[model samples]
Target chain A: MNLKTLRDYGRVIFYAAEMALRSNLTDSFVLFGILVQPIIIALLAFWMLGDRGGEYIIFVVIGSGMTGLWTSCLFISGNSITQERWTGTLELMVSTPTPVSVIVIGKILSNVLQSLASMVLSYTLAIVIFGYVPTINQPVLFTISLLLTILSYACFGLLISPVFVLNPDVQRLQNGLEFPVYVLCGFMFPIALLPGWTTPLSYILSPYWAARALHATSSQWNGLGEVALSWAAMVALSLIYLMLSSLLFKRLLRRARLDATLNIQ
Target chain B: MKAIEVRNLRRVFRATIGVVRRKIKEIVAVDDISFEVYDGELFGLLGPNGAGKTTTVKMLTTMLIPTSGEARVLGLDVVRSAEALRSRIGFVFGGERGLYWRLSGYDNLRYFASLYHVDPAVSRKRIPYLLDLVGLSDRGQEKVEGYSRGMKQRLHIARTLLHDPQVLFLDEPTIGLDPVGARELRQVVRNLQAEKKTILLTTHYMFEADALCQRIAVIDKGRIIALDTPEGLKTYVKDLAVIEFEVYGVPSNVLEQLRAQPYVHTVSVENRDQKQALLIHSPRGSQAVPDLLSMMNGIRIGNVIVREPTLEDAYVRLVGGEA
Candidate 1:
């Protein structure tokens, strides 16, 4: 792309991010989802862990953070297009010169930012209120793992958004996927403990690799090489999802225009 | 060069109904319709609900691909070159559905301006200018949710103008606005016309179409049955006069009886404050007034008058009823 085109895309992303932030800031309900839900989940997990919680406080914190991220991905990013469809802005955005994918990326980025904030809040709450702070053996690796995981989740959200737009009833799938994903990905525990048949499924889930890397880095159970491998796996999977989602988005848009279903319920 | 050209454009929608026993139904929204909008001309598409006027606009604006044939705006094909075409055209649909209600009016415009790729410096100046043009200068910073229907409509107009498009499409821009708000919006449209912009407007309001459009196309049932200048369209009813009268609680049978008359072309009824205002058209001119009054048959009738043909009369004659 030329400089002008790049500049235009940058502007589109900037404005979409601004809109996402402004709208979410005003919505008390969305704030509750981002801030309160993870804290509540962390508190309950800590109570359940009890004396065993000291050894796994970091796991609980990261697990709750990932849960918050998943929630934002499932509801915020997934429903972004649905919200726009209801507001009647979806058609307008499609008719514009900018590609809708770019606009959606901007929205995903904004939601990812909120998810990160939620993760941080969950960690702070565990440390300050629950009096549990796990030692970080590889802070740098953990940070990299966290960022890549967030990016991957954002892409995953983008992948699901177009599906929601084409079939609004699929939104119920968001609620259905939440707890199952936590269990399957081993967000609060080790995937090795799960059944052998579920190992393949965990390998395919980016969050499983993310949680593995985070847990290893915090407990020093794995070396730098192992953590690097986890990071590589998450990045590769994220790229695949990003590319696949882009293709899906284009196909969905073509179908919508041909079917004339963009404006209808 | 023509600003817009359409050839045999059509759109068919397939909708599924029923849960247990689903059935698919086909709705042909825009039939084989063709028309040209000249550069710098203000063209109006006049039609009633379900008449396919909005469907036609959607096709032209690249929101819906045509089922067959082709549409071009500013010499660029709408489907193939939609990305480039979109940059040069703007559209505003009637109602307050498109704006981000939580954001300030200015922020809404600013955001759309970016989507259209308007230069930052240009947007900085153009946004304020558009807000003022739509008479929302002082309320630019207020959240859109707090704005009234008319104010939201005006903001919609402002949003469309952010990119300085060559062509503008407005679909029923004054659908539910109060009289004063609708009039203000019409003035904004007039100002855009003064700037030599090619605009394709769709509205059910015949008077608004007559006052604004240089040429009007009356569409019904997915077809353009009549296309002409407002004055030329009015000529269709030149030989007939309209007898308008008010009555208390007129029945449908009475309207059916009036339609059965040989000289009577059409009868339209409007309800106002518990009274029905009837506009009866006939080739007999004022001579049909007495017959119309007599047909009332002891009904409480009040204030009858005869007037010359108007664009509305021509519309009723062409479209066959109220829009």
Candidate 2:
């Protein structure tokens, strides 16, 4: 990247990091809600399936980490929108010359980092405590899976904030999302374990694809051809989520309670 | 060319009601309005709550697209050239929510500077200069959340000017500040003017508008009812006469007679303990004040104060008064 691009990305990254640090630095217990719970799930998996199950536990841990990051992005729409809707910060930010992209990117970037932190920490803890390790035949897909997982979750979460702008009650809509996501993504168990009727629904959710991809890395997920399909399915899901959310997000913002969204100075 | 040009700008928002199925209702937030601010001059868009001040600012600053009409800031069309316009102006909101509560005043300035594409080294030097200009140099290292309302306001002023934009739009810059803080903030605005930065500001404070605005447009019910220099606009309330007196209980009959007096045109009993305010106006000037004071007997009065029509009086007259 050129100097200008480097500076742009640097500024965006710093803003994201600063937002995370300022908002969450003092709240240590948030780990219980986001991090420790995922770790505990991994431990529970180890307990259930013994050494064979450790791989599933690691998959759950990473998937949950992805969820934390994605959820924050999703959370930003309701959290920041409802907040700016209440406090006037949203209006203030929007009214100024700050690039709309900057604000959107800033929210996503911060969510991504915070989510990444949650993921890395849980994975580290799982490594130290549960002794979870991956089969290393192909590291590229593993890296790509995590990156794509982050991309898919963040973009989907990023799109829904404008709903909160139009309705204060929309923030509560997020709760309905968590249980359905956890169940459908098969994070708690294996996708094969879910009822046959729910299979189509799981296929559409990005996390379902993410959970399966990361799980394949550990469970030996059948063979190369099967693993490639999982990877391809995730890529398709990411694109679909990315495109759909951007369109929905733009439409919602265009129709956003522009007056109500004024965040106070 | 005008630094800012607006042509019949408008924005319509839909309001919704109910729960199971919401009913969408249309609210015309910004009605048709148009005015241009000159280059290197301070203009004020003075208004009360819901007067479309914020919406107008949003349209001018290129945040909300005008549902109709057109606005060009520094010659760039608001909708088409929004990104370019962002670099051309600075905005300082009157509230304390935008700045990072955790970062020091300097850090906040530096952060915004980065967004405006200011070079890092230049920003390092520029931030301290801005902090010093707003008289927050000593407290540059202080976290924004810890700063008093006054200090936070000063930092906001510094933050807005960090990019050194050619134009500045300030929304109620001194909204809740105390007397001293408000005065200092106005002075900073004056300095910005001296440096030739065009300012389009909005405020409810009449005195602030009088002090800083070379020209002001007072918006009410989504319309610009009055637009002129503060002194010129005060003339609109020439019929409003303010006379204060410290009286030891004036009889009702005597007060009623004073109200009927020919030269004593308008009268109002405003609430003040031991002090009665009789707003006396006449087509004839201060000539009526002496005659009215002489007519008052059986009442011990202290200092029948007659004051010239103020901008507050003009604003009240122009905007109208009611509960």
Candidate 3:
């Protein structure tokens, strides 16, 4: 790309982020979902674990926080295009000189920022209320794991974004996928606890490795090599999802143009 | 060079009906049609609802792909060079939904400016100027959700003008606005034309087309049935005179009686503020006015006038029966 095209893309990303932030700030329901849901899940985890909760407090905190992240990705990032469609802005966006992929990426970036903020809020609330602060043996690895987890989830959200455009019964699919993903990705528990057949599914899910890497880095139980492997797997899976989502984005635009569905629906 | 060139453009939509036993239906939203719009001309596409006006505009704006033929804007193919063409053309569909309601009107314009890659320095100056031009300078800081329908429509125009595009396609820009709001928007469109910009406008309002467009195309059923200058089109009804009269409470029988007159070609009734305004078409010119008054049977006639055929009369004559 030339300097001008690159500059235009940068502007697209910048403006998209600004709009998303403005929208999220003004939406009380969304703010409540992002802030309150994680705290409720953290409290539930605290009560359920009881006597053994001390050691697993960090695990539950991170899991519940990741749940908020997952919700943001699903509702905010994945459904953004559908929201645009409903608002009648999707066609206008598509007609712009900037590629749709760049616009979607900008949305993902903004949602990721919001998701990270939610994670931080969840962690702080857990620490303040429950008084359980685990020792992080490798702070650098934990930070790396956190960033990768957010990036991978953003890619996952992008992958599913096109499905909403193609299918009309997307709410059913969206509702059905949420809990299954939480279970399959081992958000609140270990994949070893799940059935044997589900292990392969967990292995391929980016969030499972993300959760694993986070837990290992926090507990310092696994060596640097194992943590690096988990990070590598997450990055590789994220790359694959991003590539697939790009193809899906192109197909979605082509289908929308051919069917004249962008403006109508 | 022609600002826009459409050659045999067409668009077909596949619609599925029923649940268990589904059937596929093919709809020709835009049939094979072609037209050219010259630079610095205010062109109008006059059509009724579901008349393929929006479909044609979508094809030229690169929002929808044509099924069989081609369209070029600013010498670039809409399909092959959409990215470059987009920078040179802008469009606004009538309605208030296309904007981000949560953002302020100024922010909305700024966001669109960024999308079009307008320089920040230029946009800073252009945005306020446009906001002022659209009469929204005072409301620019207000969130769009708080604005009225007219304000939103005005903001839409400002948003489209952010990137100083050479050509603009506006599809029914004033569909649901009040008369005052519609008049304001028409004035803005006229000003845009005065700036030497090429514009393609589509509306069902004949007077609007007559007042603004240098050339108008009357489209119906996905096809252009007539294309000419306003005066040229009006000449089609040169021999016909329209007798328009208002009645406070005219019954349907009186309308039927008027229609039964051999000299009266057609009678159309329009309800205005609880009163009925009847438009009678006849080749007898003002000579038929005396007969129309007598047929009223001493009914409360408020205003009666005999005038030459308007662009609306010409439109009704051409597409009245078929549409």
Candidate 4:
């Protein structure tokens, strides 16, 4: 509400993010999601779509990179609160003056930023292994889209962490929720190929708009109008997610306190 | 001057059972407990396992909303003003689980300091001081995972003091510490109390409570059975004397016979190596010792002695006779 409070929140976020990054460096599962899995997916995409020609190489790179980002968000960021619970720090985090959501935002920021290494790795794979140079058709627009993607993805992650913590049954669906997003977001192929009924589901997901924006900028220029629409969708969805996540966090705390389940690992 | 006030605070947990036909069972963890902790006083909640000590602390710390009634710390209602109160009070739930194992002790302190909104300038100076105070300055840079359990417990104490809160809650702070470590931690608690910090400590260790707390509340089965100073509690058993018998192979039937005696207040047994130490509490005092020894006719009796009742004896009786 005040500047000092905001500054305190900002510091908490940065501190939380820094600690998460430090802690995540040794996690083999996180390393696989951010580093190894994306490269494997990119290699497979290159071999599978080789017949599609050189122009599609950049598309595969972006698609595979986006898959890495979604994977990290789904597994790492989604489990942020649950991880705290496991460590027995959820009670401490909740007891702090700073809001738990701010701390989680910081953790999501680190995971997303760390996952960006997937894009760099994919680009390197194309350059070194395949002897191909992939360039962004619209570098400035691509950069803007990248920033919005991070914001939207962070917000999306915000919604997920609380849900997973509150409903472990939904968390059991985590592995199942991964590849569907890749297909629905058209990470390796166009969603246009999917059944019409699922289009709305894809449209509702911020990652789909992110993939469309990135793919359009990297391989094909779908037009400024289309890119702007994707940006609008991402921005709007991010705001909605932020608002919804606030409600979810409130409910989460209330339910946890009432049920006395915050410390029940 | 009251730092903490609790009025008829109660918490009921609904535990669901069965896979197909679910049944919700209500468990009253804390039932209508009322007390006040004055500022600068060291208060102890003494109880055995499942005595709702942790539940009471959780409610006061605003981690769990009371199922009914009220708890206020630092003049703020725990439920209504939780956010405002969090920074003003500190707590440690006894364990090795709370710290970030991957992070160094210093970094863990830094992280929690920021969470408490401690000024960067203050934290920079205070972090090293706290590390030194907890005797971890030499190892502060090492990952917490490498620290011993006692070291981790000490670090938890330092972590809670990051904001210099006025009110503190410690739930079983020395649960598993060795004697020396537990003694050192108790000294630290004493020093905090000396600095005029109001503290509420919960522990099953009666000696720790006796050594540290100015006043103690003995809770059992979701109720406060006794609230008094160590001396005051000891008085509850003053009418009785404790007689001890060191014997090998004391039969259960003989133990039951001692318990069944009209003059016997309570009988408890402690198993030592190859022997059982029997403590019999009664108003009959040493006069009953001969009869008690006569009852265990077949046992190999070693040493027999009579002593005055202590806070632990009072506690055992108040909690319904299990030490």
Model 3 ranges off by over 4 Å: B248-262, B289-302, B321-323
| Residue-level lDDT tens digits of model 4 in B1-323 | 99999999999999999999999999999999999999999999999999999999999998999999998899999999999999999999888998999999999999999999999999999999999988899999999999988899999999999999999999999989998888889988998999999999999988889999999999999999999999999999999999888988777888788889999988888788989888889998989988887888878989988999989899988976776
What is the C-alpha local distance difference test score of candidate 3?
0.86
lDDT of 1 by residue, B181-300 (tens): 999999999999999999999999999999999999999999999999999999999999988898888888888999999999888887788898888888887788877778889789
The 10 consecutive residues of candidate 2 chain B with the worst lDDT sum are B314-323
RMSD of every prediction: 1.6, 4.4, 2.3, 1.2
lDDT of 2 by residue, A1-265 (tens): 4887666656755764576556655555444545565566556655665455555555656666755654565555346556544554455455444444355656665666666776677667667776765343346777776677766665555555555554557666777776677778876576678789999999887778777776666554566776677778877877776666566655655654344344433
True contacts kept of 4: 0.97
Q: lDDT of each model, Cα atoms only? A: 0.87, 0.71, 0.86, 0.92
Model 2's number of clashes is 12
Between prediction 1 and prediction 4, the one with superior DockQ is 4
Residue A79: error of model 2 in Å?
3.1
lDDT of 2 by residue, B28-102 (tens): 877888899999999998877888898888777766778889999999998888767877887777776776777
A best-first ranking of the candidates according to their lDDT comes to 4, 1, 3, 2
Evaluate every candidate with DockQ and list the scores.
Answer: 0.87, 0.40, 0.85, 0.93
- Clash totals for all models, in order? 0, 12, 0, 0
Chain A TM-score, prediction 1: 0.92
True contacts kept of each: 0.91, 0.34, 0.84, 0.97
Which residue pairs overlap in candidate 1's backbone? none
- The C-alpha local distance difference test score for the whole of candidate 2 amounts to 0.71
